[model samples]
Target chain A: MSTLEITDLHVSVNTEDGPKPILNGVTLTIKDGETHAIMGPNGSGKSTLAYSIAGHPKYTVTGGTVTLDGEDVLAMSVDERARAGLFLAMQYPVEVPGVSVSNFLRTAKTAIDGESPKLRTWVKDVNNALQALDLDPTFASRSVNEGFSGGEKKRHEIAQLELLDPKVAVLDETDSGLDIDALKIVSEGVNRFASKGNKGVLLITHYTRVLRYIKPDFVHVFVAGRIAEQGGAELADQLEAEGYDKYTSALR
Target chain B: MTVTDVARESVASALEQAPVVSHLNPLPSYDLADHPVPTGREEVWRFTPIKRLRGILDGEPSDARLEWDTSVPEGIEISTITAEQARELGELPPNERPAALAVARSGGAALIDVPAELAPGEPLVIRLTGASVDDLVWGHLVFRIGNHADVTIVLLHSGSARYCATTSFLVGDGARVNVVSLQDWADDAVHLGRDAIRVGRDASVKHTSVSFGGDVVRMHANVEYAAPGGEAELLGLYFADAGQHLEHRLFADHNQPRTKSNVAYKGALQGQGAHTVWIGNVLIRKVAEGIETYEENRNLVLTDGCQADSVPNLEIETGEIAGAGHASATARLDDEQLFYLRSRGVSDVEARRLVLHGFFNDLIRKVGVPSLEGRLTQTVEVELAKTVLAGVPLGASLILPVEEVAD
Candidate 1:
């Protein structure tokens, strides 16, 4: 079983002032077939944790240990972490100019699988993945994330998640900016992946509306660079009824 | 106020409100005396590294000739004629020093004549290959397209030489023409060339200049309408390696009413001392009302110590024009785009190559030569191999693995 364990991670981002610490003494774990949703308000260092796990050059890990299936994730480069089965669906995926989505997916698939995918099967898989996300089969020909609407960008990410099939996926605010119908479509796509029962998902969002569709096994109250509290799925309902005011007010 | 209201009081008052013409483009002349050798201080020659030109501006006489290979159809003619015959046959005169030298020293012009109503799906290919880098060659060519004709011309230059040439296109009424000039010269070759076109009434012309392999390549493409309703599109693409200097100058003169012109050029520079320049100018005279013109230049500096100078100048005399605009930009490889691609499991090498290919893919598609597209793509890949793929020491990840051959 694939397991991702982050132990007491301390991260800082370099700013005009200095190294501004964003994540402090944060620890979490997601085991096989488990979906953990980390609910936090703005400035909670949730997205920072996601990018750090994926080894973005913008963030520095002062003290931490991230292991994926007993392999040192922190020691690997960005692409190596990806090959080692770590995926980060970005909050704002940047637009890649003139690189068609079809070509991009194929390149990614080749890099992940260490060889070219079978053309006939690969094309069919791409069309099927995009179709399941309500994206047109023609969408495969477009440039990656270029000129995509808000819902389309998120759905395109989900399509990539399905096609890439990483061991652990860190979805950073995938539900934000999505309409109700698009949210349902994206949630169903996630549920289909979760149902496979071989992958681990760490869903980071500010809303409990998505948890209603894809049930999370656990919910952690994240605030101000650390986890304020932790509980089972019921904690999501409590946070929906009562926002993170208590935690932020305590920090204040 | 009768016609007497327009009477001149001295010559200065009558000329006070006249449209201003650019000094960058000197008046065209058949006499070589009118075109002077520049000292690198002239506005048109300021960006050019004059020393690297290797005395091409000196206009010395040379007897060398480039080997010419042509594919002329049955209805077309390829023959040699005197410069006097060329000018008598309505060829645009040279407007610059290098071009004037080319016409003055080339001895004669190669005339390619296409008959009226001759529409060929196949391109007319002219391949000129030089023998040595020490060879000093001058060339003059006049392509005459008759009324209502449609033609695509491909001019290919290769090998090594210090070559200066002038070419003219006399397009007749209602004709359509596409001319692609590919400068794939040797690394030591220096070329100074100019293309001047006179578009007849209702005619359309598309001229594309692509320079990939040259040490010092300076080219100019000038267009002026012979009558109203004519249109011109000037497109250019170039790549400059270390110590290479590539320059392109474009001039669109709207001498007739209701005309249109569009100019776009894209270039990429890699390695130290790699420099590129794009100068685009459009002059709309007072008579040229209701015209539309736009010019854009984009440069991608792929490495350190590379310079790209892009200048777009528009001299519009009439405010009644439909549109007039220009854009110029030069940028380095984007880090965010690289990270985005690498986050998808793409290796550093592949990610960089993909980003660059994406940068040029849109402009390459606009070349409109389907047969040459694959070749151009391959050439771009080869150019990338000299820098990014050759292991410029961008970490250990930039180098390709054993199994990662060309995909």
Candidate 2:
């Protein structure tokens, strides 16, 4: 089974003031078939952890070690990280003009799998994935995420997660802008992916609503770039009853 | 009778209903001796680097050797006629000095005439290959399409030479014509040409210019309607590499009522000293009521040290026109798009290649010539390799399947 390990990850981003630290000495570990929920308020460095693990050039890893199944994850390029079984469903999916969704999906699959997929079966798979997400078949011909609504963008991300089938999927705030119907559809897609056994999922969100659908195995409260508390699934229910004020006030 | 012939008969009868305007003036002519040499001060010649004209504007003609090969379809006639013969065939007067000089020094014009009501099944192709001679060369060509005829003309230019040519089209009533001019000259070649088209009543003309080669290439394409209910579509595609200057200027004058014009041009620039200029002008005269016009120009800059200048101008003296609009844009590669592609396991180099191909795909499809479309796609690929993809390592898998490798 694949294991993603992060040790004392110190991440910083360049801002107008200077290189401001976002993630300070944060540590987390997730193994295959485990769903880890990271619940944090705004400005708690939750998304920074996801971007850093995905090897985004914008986030600098000053003092940290990230390993995927004992392989150096921090040293890989963004595309290499993706090929090495890491996937990121960005909070705001970028609009890629001129690249059809079908082409993008096939290219990513080919690149990650190291071979071109069988056309007949691949087309069927893509259609099925899009159908599961409630996206029309014609959506495959349009430019990726270009002119798509907020809910459509999230649905497309889930569709990608299903098609790519990465070892570890880091979804950052995927439920923020989605409506109730879209939220349920997206959660169902994620559930289907997680049901495929031996897949790791790191769901970063500020609400416990998505947890009700996906049913995380573990919950961690993040505050000020560090994990303040950790528990089993019951902690999520407690946080929903209360709020992040206790955690933020304790950090202050 | 053919449908176009029937339409022409009806349009001829309806032409009497078009209003005559006394205020619509003709374009300024430089054929007279009093028209002073452009010091880069005139509005029309302001953007042109006059010093690089190689004395073509000073009445000095080059003795360069140019080889001509043409494939004429059946029922079409081609002949070499003197300038006087061409003028007698309704060739309009030159509006600029370069065209005037070409007409004055060419001594003769290559004329292609299509008879009335006869449509050729194949395109009329002409290949003009220039030798490495430094002397300036002047050429004049005329295409005459008779009433209700449909034709396609492909003008291909290649090799190296300092050349200037003036091409004129006389389209008859209700005729449909598509003229594609491709400038694929070798490096160090300088070219200046003017194409003037006169569209007849109820007729439509599609004029396209594709520029990819040469050190300095400039073309002026102007259109004027001979009668009402005419239509013109001006399309251009260009790629400018290092140390090259490519300029395309277009003007569509709507002097008749119920006329329409659409102009779209797209270009890409890369490397140092690469420059491209697009100037689109549309004038709707007071008498040209119910006219519709739209002009758009877009440029993609692939690298630093390159400049793309796009100017779209619409001068309308009539408020009764259906629609009139113009747009221009020049942009570099989108960083977000690059990141999105890269995040999907596409390498940096492959991502860029895809973006560049997509930038030119829409315009290339609009060209509407199957054979020409394939060649342009290959040309764009080669251009990308030469400039932007020069140093990047293109992965072996990106080009070929793993099974194809010998190892």
Candidate 3:
């Protein structure tokens, strides 16, 4: 019952040089029960699309309209968009030094649900979610992302995605830096989240190794801030073999 | 068997014969001639707002008194004695003018004795409440924690007063002690406080100074080892509001080999004219080899018109040491951290509350007063509500619940 629609999205990020344009007139849509993978090269603006959709203060929306179920997502604040069912699994999760994972998750859940979760059930849920990601129960007491290894940080993000249970999730490079075991665990967590049959997944990645496990229904080839081509899941395998050189050479 | 027991034989005879006092200190002396009124140009007085002292620097005697409310645990003795008796009990001499003035002007001193190996079940609470800002009180207190004894002592200040105190903690060998002096005065109050600690062999002492109120409060905690294997942890926390000055100074003198000293202080400033100063000075004498020491200070700026000065100093005379280092940082709330919290559905206001509270949570945990932790968190919330969270009620739904710090 969730539909995230992006129309002609344009984004520019602030740098010492200037507001350099990173995303240019990109359009895409993610509907319920569908997994869409946006695969591209290193500088393809794939992560930019994810962060922009999540309302990060770093990115400026020069142009475009993003809506969730016909409501203007562009008009909402970051937390408001989150409450409206848009979740972004950041590629580089920031470290919060003194906030424990359980505390953070409960706080976020309270904010999103507009009511505090029952403590007993919430603690059990958190432990279960962490265990599913191959994380220890004691990990709930650790400060968020602080001193976490690459695998731990990514796994924690997937844990949040499962617990927050938002309608539409835009994961930006959640599979990077994860080994095979971690990749499988994180993919399973994402699959579990998307398997609800009512949630939309916009899985953005640089490689097709993760796509093989998650099985995306649609694939968009991203190049120079725009989608150069579109196809089914087989396009991910093709990109993995042939790479994005063919897509970038035409523009060069 | 302990040095304290031997010192009980004769303080003058023991100290005069020890020949262990480091030349670098040069500040602790019983003579009033050794301490002079500062022109605010001296290293110790430069960062202080001397003019705001209102003649306290003159060291004039005052008969004013702060009403005391005490919770005396079992096996502890609190008695009034002369400052001369305190000195005879082996308490270190006053270092600076305020402390020397406190010892000179106060007619008598309060002495609390925790007998050898005695463990108190509850914290010995000494709550002092001043009647008005007009009261200029001089305080002298001597605390003697005996060998192998474990104890926690809390000294809380509130209401209004110009109070100057020279307190001493003489911890005996193998003793474990946690001393917390909380400066929660009224807005009009000014306080000049000092704590001089002599940590015995293998003893561990944790002294915390927390300043959240007062017009001008400058507090100092200085430590020196009585013998080797002594460990001292000095902690400080402060919050300065508009037009308020809160200063904390620490000096750790390692005159004995194989000793350790660690100092960590965190502060927050908000509103116009809010200022805080932290000076951490560690002096390692030539004989003090194989010592480990580190000092750190962090400040969070919550508003535009606030100033936080953090200075860390380490003077090592000997090259043969285990380790020595210092760190300092002053910054506003991190933007990326805010974005991460907000993207998780925490509102802007709540995210800020979490970050600011989180900034102090770790240090409060280190404060080690379990009963006072909750109250400290609430006090921080009230301080925040003054500016950054203005118009937000203490019970507002926007204020996130303070969680138990796990670190």
Candidate 4:
């Protein structure tokens, strides 16, 4: 029913030396009901790609066509893109003070659906999703992402993904700062969203540990701002066993 | 240039005995009871309009009255004091001087004290009204809160007579008090007020007030955290409609270690020739190490002819504290915040309310009383409705669903 497509995408950041490229000529597409894993080394522009696709104002999309279900995603505002069913499970989400997690999720859900959720159903849905991630119900009242531990913050991102139920999600290193237990819980939350069939996930990460839980149908290796290799789940195994030496040399 | 010249001229003038004329002594000798007129040259009065003082010699005397038929809310005790009784209290211990000024100036003033350690209750309403009498008049009140006491005093001053008011507050250690002083005077009435506050150790005093509908208002509030670990939160919300001018000046001093002070004052100016000025100075002494101080003054200019002037200064001698910051911004309605709200199905007027409510929410919620919060929300919403919804089709039957817009 829906798909997220990034074609010849290039990203950059403004620096003292003028705009410097981060993501270069990386093209990827994930149809609805598909799961795609993007593995890459640090500084390979994986997170940049995720933020750029989500329309983060801080990231500049220098060259690309990012569209969702034929809609020009790159032209949409941050909230507009989000409301269009695009979700980003940030590696390190910003801590928005005075905004509670439940409140944020409810607002996002309302914005995406263009209607208010049933209050009775919302409470139950939020509680169940939080429980699945081992989060305390009391966290609903706390400020969004504020004062949360590394593991708790990661779990919160997943909880948002589960509750908002976006049509497409960009998981940017969701397991980076997470421990083994938190990684499993986060992976489980991701798998739950994928099981919904209409949701597409672009899981970006460096390590292969999270792959053990949520097996990706396609894994793409990113190097020097572009995808260098594409294969099945065995690609994760090969990278984990042999490392990214060949891709690094090719990027050089 | 000196007060002696003004006093001499007044004493020598045939108009000296005129019904409205009040004796003016040398500047240094003028009792605090005698209202002081600014020459418009004084540093503190630089931003203030000088003409507001011209009516002092001709305005009708005030015969103000205190009307509270609804009775003071439970937990708060109120009593009146005569000028003679206050004078008997003498200079009042320097420590209690702030609260004593009100008693000293009262023809009949009210005294309010909340019991210690009692659960906070509904806000206490203190409504001061003045008859449309001929001449300048003065009223005063003294307020004291006991240890761990919590209360909100709504002081509303309104009338046609020229009114001068003085209120003094003493917050005991560990006490928490929120005071909302609203001044809405007649178009021709000149309202002058001075407030002095002394916060005890570990105590907190919050003062939020709005000045509107007044011809000319000059208000001064001086706060001092004289004991270690004391804290004070000061918020000023004022809106000057067409042809109105409101000036607010504040002085917050931190003389004890570990004391904290925060000031957030915002004003909206609209219509032709509406002018507002805010001058705030916060001093953190060297001896007041570990003290934290922050001040912010923001203004919203809603019309082309409206003007707002703000100067927030912080004098910090030591940096031993955890944090100290100050921010002041003056501009028209934020188009960004407005558009963001409007896109969410809120009409333009409702969108403005959301933005303005968000602007003041940081301070209103700090009042710590839900009922009072609701009341102030109504007050601000009404004022905003008058400005933003003016000439619009919104009727009394139109109720825009506010919902949970805070997040």
Candidate 5:
């Protein structure tokens, strides 16, 4: 079992003007088998928290402590964090023009596992994962996210999540651009991953619709670079009805 | 004035009023005296570092010998013929000094002839290995493809010597030919070569040049149609490492109506002093109506301190052509690509390697030689390894100062 603990995490990003603080004293803890949903309005630091945990170069951790089962996650490099069983489903998945999906997946797997996977079973596993996400087996030969649709991109992330099987997944707005059918497909994929019973899910989203499919054990209402309130899944429903107005006004 | 006289006068005036726009000068002569030695000021020799040419432009001759081998399939003829005998087949006029010198010095030429209506089962292979020599070596070669014949020729160069050569092709009516000329010389070798091809009626020719080694290698390939319904495709691939100079210049003269030409060249440069030059010129003459032509060049800079020069020129004497266009681009690795790969757990080095491979993959596939594909891929991998180590570190560090990020 793995536990992710983020305490007093202060992150800032450099802009044209100067260093701008994005996440101000945000703290959260997620243990194995728990799903925590972070909902917020635009520019409320939800994605910042996700990128910070994944060690994106753009976000500087000014003052924070992030640990994975007592291991110092903040001290690790981006790839090291990934090898330590942390994954980030980016909001905007990048397009790599010439690298095929199969090659990228295999290379990532090899890097994470510290050895090359057996080719015979690996190909089968990749095909099965792609099929599970409603992606064509031929998609493996296509360049990584080069010309994929929004729904396809989200589904590919879920497929990767299932195949990589990280201990913790910080999904940043994976359901934002998905339609109803795509939302269901992606939610089911995430739910299947959660059902594994040994992973932690930190789902970042702006709407409560995805929460309807993949129930969150904990819901945090984020405002002004910090979590203003936290409660059980009922809090998501309350925010759904009331919206972020209450939190934003209270912060003001 | 009479009606006929008035009509003729108007037509003559209209023809006189039309502006004459020349895209390229007329083809130079093969006689050494007809062309003056270049002082590097001429447009054709401006990009070349002429001083390093070791006086070859001044008609310098070397006593060095090159080891030659040919592997031909049955029914194909190969023989060595004196320069006098070669002239009987056809007159191959040189357009530049190196070509003129090569023709003047080469006592004999290696001739490869394919019979009419015969399709070769396999590609004919020619291997020319240069011994380590300081003297300048000159060579001349001729390829004659018979009517309706189809063949592929592979010319491989290796080892070390200062060399200059000219290769000519005579494509018969309705014939199809593909020629791959690879320049993989030693680090100290300097090579200058010219390829002149004459495409006959309804014939198709594809010429590909691949350059990887040599301190200084410059190749000029020109194509002209002997009759209408001819086609030519010129493709080039080059990689220049530190202190190496590799240049490829191409000209396609559309002198016959209904002919077609296409030119594409791609290159990669890395390390300090690594330079590459690509010049593509296409001229559509007034009589060459209903012709189509396009040229494109792209370069990838793997590190700082390397230069890539690409020039595409199109000169149309008449506005009646079907289509004419050209494009060129030189760029470094995309930062977003590197970030995307790194975010997926690929190390910086591995990510760069993948990007370089992808950049060259499409061009390499166009060669279509199955036997050489694997070796070329491995060669690129090895080249990347050597240059990747000495270049600017791949993928910027995450830690950024206030000043650094602001800019």
Candidate 6:
């Protein structure tokens, strides 16, 4: 079984004024067959944590370390970290006009698996994944994320997560910009993937609406780059009703 | 050592060899010397480096051809156009000759001509090999697209050679033609070439050019939307390495109303002194009301010493045109774009190639010829790998070597 462990990880971005801390110190771990949710308000470093863990160049690791199954993940390059069984579903996936989503997903799968998949099996797998996401097969012909509606983009990410099937998945604000129908469909796809054997998920979001559909095994509150509170499903419900007003005041 | 002296000498030599030559001939009237170095003064040479072109003016033209590999598609017929054949077709009225013609004499060169109205299954391929030689050599290709016809032409240059070339094309009324040019020369050659096209009424012309080699190269293309309702599209992509300089000058004239012309050129430069330049000049004449014209040039400088310069100019004499504008931007690779690809398990080298391929995808996919576009993509990816991977920060691990990265 694989596990993604973040040990007191802190991140900062090199701005014109110098390094400004984004994630103060985020520590969490998600083991195989588990889905963990990190809920926080705007600027609470939720997305920063997602990007930092995914090895995005803009997010610098100021301190601490991220490890995957005993390997130092933070020391690995972005793609290396990814190939080591990790994935991040970006909130604002870029519109790559020349590459089709099918092409991108297959290429990613090959990179992770170190070889091309059997043609018929790969086709069937891709079709099944797209169907699960309620996407047309024609989406294979369209450029990756180009001109896709907000809902379509989210579904496309889920489609990738389903097709690639990484050991660990980091979904960064995947629930944003999605309608209720889209959210339900997207959640269903996530649920299906989460049920797969030996898979881990780090679900980052600000709202509890998504948690209602794909229940997270653990819920953590992120504030100023660190996890300030840890609890279970009821914690998400409490935040949804009471909000982060209490957490913000306590952090200050 | 100015361009004028060289042009004058070339023209004088041609005159001495021609039996019907006259001292008062107005056909070669555009004197390279009399015209001030095109310093963004002319609308056509605006986006290109006016000063850097000075290096090409004094350099000796040679007939040198290197022995690098050449790739040409199979099945397409290839033939050289003879002087006799050109004479039989009649002279291209004085007004139709491009300014580059003053240096291109008819007898010393060979021309590739694709038959009118013939659509071959594969692209007509022309491979020009050059090596270091003292004498100047000229090559001309005349492509005549007959009414309602369509075809594709691929031109590849490889080897160590220093020479200048001229390509002239004419599209008959209502004809459509697509031409793709790829110049993948040895890293140690000097190259200069010019393209001049004439579009007839209701004719459509599409041209794509990719440059990936040579020590210094300057290419100029002139398109005349000579007839009403004619459409012309000129797209180009180039990658330059250290000590290399690439320049492009484009001219589009909307000579009639309801005509359209679009130009977009993008380049990536890396290494020390890798300089790239783009100059676009468009003219919307008084009679060209309702003409639609757009020009855009974007560049990516991936290294500290690399440089890119772009200049766009629009000469609109009337406000009747529906659209006329130009856009030019130069920036480094987008970190976000790279991160997005890398996060998908694509190694740094592969990730960069994917992003670059995507950056040029809009144009390559538009080439409309799958095999040809695929080959060009490979050619550019190879060139980009040499410098892009080398520039990566130390201690940074990459998934594949620059050469191993594929699209």
Docking band of candidate 4:
incorrect
The predicted structure with the larger lDDT, 2 or 4, is 2
Computed on C-alphas against the true complex, the DockQ of each candidate is 0.44, 0.25, 0.46, 0.08, 0.34, 0.34
Q: Candidate 4 regions off by >4 Å?
A: A10-22, A59-63, B1-36, B39-41, B47-70, B74-84, B87-120, B128-138, B144-151, B157-164, B170-176, B182-192, B199-206, B209-219, B224-362, B378-407
Q: Which consecutive 10 residues in model 6 chain A have the weakest lDDT in total?
A: A54-63
For candidate 4 chain B, the 10 contiguous residues with the lowest summed lDDT are: B398-407
Residue-level lDDT of model 2, residues A53-83, one tens digit each, is 8876667788878999999887777788889
Better of 2 and 4 by DockQ: 2
Of 1 and 2, the candidate ahead on DockQ is: 1
Candidate 5: tens digits of C-alpha lDDT, residues A123-236: 999999998889999999988888999999999999988888899999999999899999999999999999999899999999999999999999999998999999999999
Q: Report the C-alpha displacement of residue B381, candidate 6, in angstroms.
A: 3.4
Off-target runs (Cα >4 Å) in candidate 5 are: A238-252, B1-26, B80-93, B200-203, B227-231, B255-262, B284-294, B316-327, B389-407
Candidate 2, DockQ to 2 decimals?
0.25
How do the residues A15-122 of candidate 4 rate in per-residue lDDT, one tens digit apiece?
Answer: 788678898898999998889999999999898888677655446777778889999887765566667788888777665444556656676677667888999999
Quote the TM-score that chain A achieves in each candidate: 0.99, 0.99, 0.98, 0.97, 0.99, 0.98
Task: Give per-residue CA lDDT, model 3, range B353-390, as digits (tens).
Answer: 88888888888889888998998888999888886566
**How do the predictions measure up, each by TM-score?**
0.93, 0.85, 0.94, 0.72, 0.88, 0.83
- Report the lDDT tens digits of candidate 4 across residue range B1-407: 68997886655454333322211111212143343444666575576565764455232344545444434766677777665543343212211121233333445655666767654556777666666634466666677677888777778777765666667687788988888787776777777677768788899888876787578887877677748988888888888888888988777766678888888888887778889988777766556788888888888777678788887777665567756778888987655444333322334565455456656665567656576667667767767776676634323222221111101
* Model 1 per-residue lDDT tens digits across residues B118-155: 99888899999999888999999999999999999999
lDDT of 5 by residue, B1-407 (tens): 99998997676456445432233543566578866888788888889998887777777656666898888977789889887776677644777788888888887888888898889879999999998747678999988889999999999998888889989888999999999999999998889999889898999999999999998999989888889999999999999999999999998988789999999898999878999999998878777899999999999887778899998988776678889999999988776666666666766677777777877776788788888889888888878878663445533422222223334
Q: Model 1, B36: alpha-carbon shift in Å?
A: 1.3
> What value does the lDDT take at residue B403 in candidate 3?
14
Residue-level error in angstroms, candidate 1, position B54: 1.4
Worst 10 residues of 1 chain B by lDDT: B398-407
Q: For model 4, what is the error of residue B73's alpha carbon versus the real structure, in angstroms, after optimal superposition?
A: 3.4
By lDDT, the better pick of 1 and 2 is 1
Positional deviation of residue B261's Cα in model 3 after best superposition, in angstroms? 1.1
Report candidate 4's fraction of native contacts: 0.00
